[model samples]
Structures are given as C-alpha cells and as structure tokens.
Target: MIIGYVTNFNLNQLDFNIKLKIQSDKFISSNCRKQYVKYLLDFEFRKNFHCIGIPIIKDPPKDSFVIGHHFFNDQENRKIGSYIFSYCFEKRHYVNLPDFTFNTLLILSHPKSGMLHFKDRNKRILFIKPKPKYISLCTSREDICGPIFMKQKANIIKKIDIEVDDNCEIGDNCICKNKTLKESENDLKFIYFVPKNTN
Candidate 1:
C-alpha cells in the first residue's frame, strides 16, 4: 500500500493530486482487480480529491512498501496528508518530504526488498522516522515548503537536529534522522527492507 500527494506549482495555481497504488499477487482474476481499482477510484478521503491507483496484470515484487509526500496547497491537500499521516501512525511507519515543492517522483517500490539500483547515483536521499508531533505539523500547512523549515512560524515545521553517520542502513523500528546517502563516497544505492511482522 502506497499513498502520497503530487504537486505541480505554477505561477497562478498549484496542481495537487493524490495517488495510491496497491500491488498484490492475490487478485486472482482481472475482474477482481478491476473492481478493486474501481473501489479505490470511487473512494474519496476528501470531498473532491479521489485517490488514483493503476492496476497491474503482473504481480509486483515481494515485501514492497514505499512512502513519501510532495507538497500541501489547500484544505483538501491537508486532509489527504492527514489521512496518510494517520495511517502511518497507526502502522508505526514514518513519512518524509523534501524541502521544496518541485517535479519529483514521490513513491518507489519493489516486491523483493533489498538493495535498490538507481540510474542517478548522485541523487540526494535521506530516510528518517520523524517524531509524531512533527508528522502532525506536516499536514497543517497550505504552502510550498518542505517538512523542514528554516524559521519557526505558525505554519512552518521546524528542522529537526540529529547526528547522522556518513552512510548507514536503517533497520526496522528504529528512530533516527539525517541518515543520508548523498554523503557517502561509495556507490551505495541499496535500501534493505524487512517485511513488517503483522502478527
């Protein structure tokens, strides 16, 4: 299950869209998949914004889970962000967003979780499980700022300070910040993923 917002910031208006994708090998029949997709298409977490999910015929790789957000623009965006935030909180997961709103891929996943290969080695990537209060701050804004802000204001979510290693892999259920990949000299692109224990 993946959910996040995509933003297109223009001079006059901002195009905010919510997207979701659920890949499973258990959808046995095409009709079942189509119906599930239809359900997601019709389901509205907010009044006017509906989640968009593309159904695939082929099975996705195992233990796939990816999450991130782009930007928030209005009450609708906040509502959707809050929805995703609440879901993550209930499941004890984390959410991270960039510092600014730009054209970027917001979600990535694979069935078999291991080292992920990327064409762009210089891409800056950081993974952190922000404190719960900070997660709430992310869903209350209607502007073009990332989760980390320079100045603390009524709407700004302040930047979190934490020490990070040059390059390290974060384990499941760990809480840390600034574990960045861009700081490493080695071509390290792998993000190991262990399936969450549902039991």
Candidate 2:
C-alpha cells in the first residue's frame, strides 16, 4: 500500500519527492535489471533519491528482512505490486517486551474506564478499519489525531496476574528463523489468513 502510494505520489500527481528504502537479508535475484549483492540499490525520483540496502543480508539477525520475490522492471506500472512484509521498525513504538519479539503492536489501555485492562484487542490493534473518508485507513475509532481520547500510552511497572498470552504464528511467506513465540496472542485462532474470535 505504501509503496504503491509512494510511486503514484512521486511521479504523476504530486510535485515534491518521496524516497523509500527497503533493507533485506536474502540476495535479491535479478536477471536483466541487475540486483547488486552486498551493495546499495539506488532509485531516482525528481531531485530526490531512493535507496535499498543489504543490512540484514550481511549479518542475518533475528526478525530481520528477507527477499520475497524477484525484481520486475515495470516502467509504466512502477511500484504497483503486493508488498508482504514480515517485520517493520518504529523507534517510538518500541516496548521492552521480554518475551514478545516482533514489530507490530503497542499495548494501550482504555481511557474512560481507568482500569488497567485493555479493550477489544482485535479492533484497536489487529485490523485496520477506515472511516467515511478513505484517507485514514489505519486510523482507529479510539484515535483522534495523536491525542486519542479513548486510548493512552502506559508502561507496565508491575504486572499483576496478567498471564501473557503466547499464541504466535509464522506469516504465509515467512523466511526469518528467529521469530519469537511471544508475538502471538491468546485469542488468535485463524482459519487460513483470516482471524477468528470464537474463543
């Protein structure tokens, strides 16, 4: 979604520039366009520049990047493709989850109840639902810009009987070896890729 958005945003409609970088471990095999191993990839957009590098490929760490598919040189339909990512990083969203070891969640608490318990874990965190306007697809109902009224940031100074749910699963095309079991939740029962909340 973001890559396609960036492609369209970079070339056709907008004026400025949007650069993107994808770092992966596996060697991105290419026949014609030439994918450089142990080197940096460079893509030009207006005056701005975009680059992809081989950071994880050098050391190949736990929860690192992996090559998904071969390269396609599509000039007309640039950057229009299904992007399946296993790991992502946000320095701000980092929590010291001793057990959990993936990069996709931020444990938040209900604002009104003032109870330490969380609300529906799935709606606020798992799925992405958009409002009447289609721009903010990932925006939750509890979110109102940065200062959401229904949710707030908190740190677990002391965990009281909160039995950490350890229900984790590998992605459909997961290649990384050191995935953490703590990334799973207690209520995650999936029929194929679709999650079920029957529990």
Q: Model 2: residues >4 Å from true position, as ranges?
A: 1-12, 27-180, 185-199
Model 1 per-residue lDDT at 194: 23
Tens digits of per-residue lDDT for model 1 on 56-136?
324322332222322222454233331111002233333231111111111233221223222221131122112111121
Q: In terms of TM-score, which candidate is strongest?
A: 1
Task: Give the runs in model 1 whose Cα sits over 4 Å from its true position.
Answer: 1-135, 139-157, 170-199
TM-score of each: 0.17, 0.16
Q: What is every candidate's alpha-carbon RMSD to the true fold?
A: 19.8, 19.0
Cα error, residue 171 of model 1, in Å, equals 9.6
Per residue, candidate 2 scores C-alpha lDDT tens digits across 61-126 of: 355223211111223333211111222232211111121111111112211111111224333332
Q: How much lDDT does each candidate structure score?
A: 0.25, 0.21
TM-score of 2: 0.16
In candidate 1, where is summed lDDT lowest over 10 consecutive residues? Answer: 33-42
Clashes of 2: 2
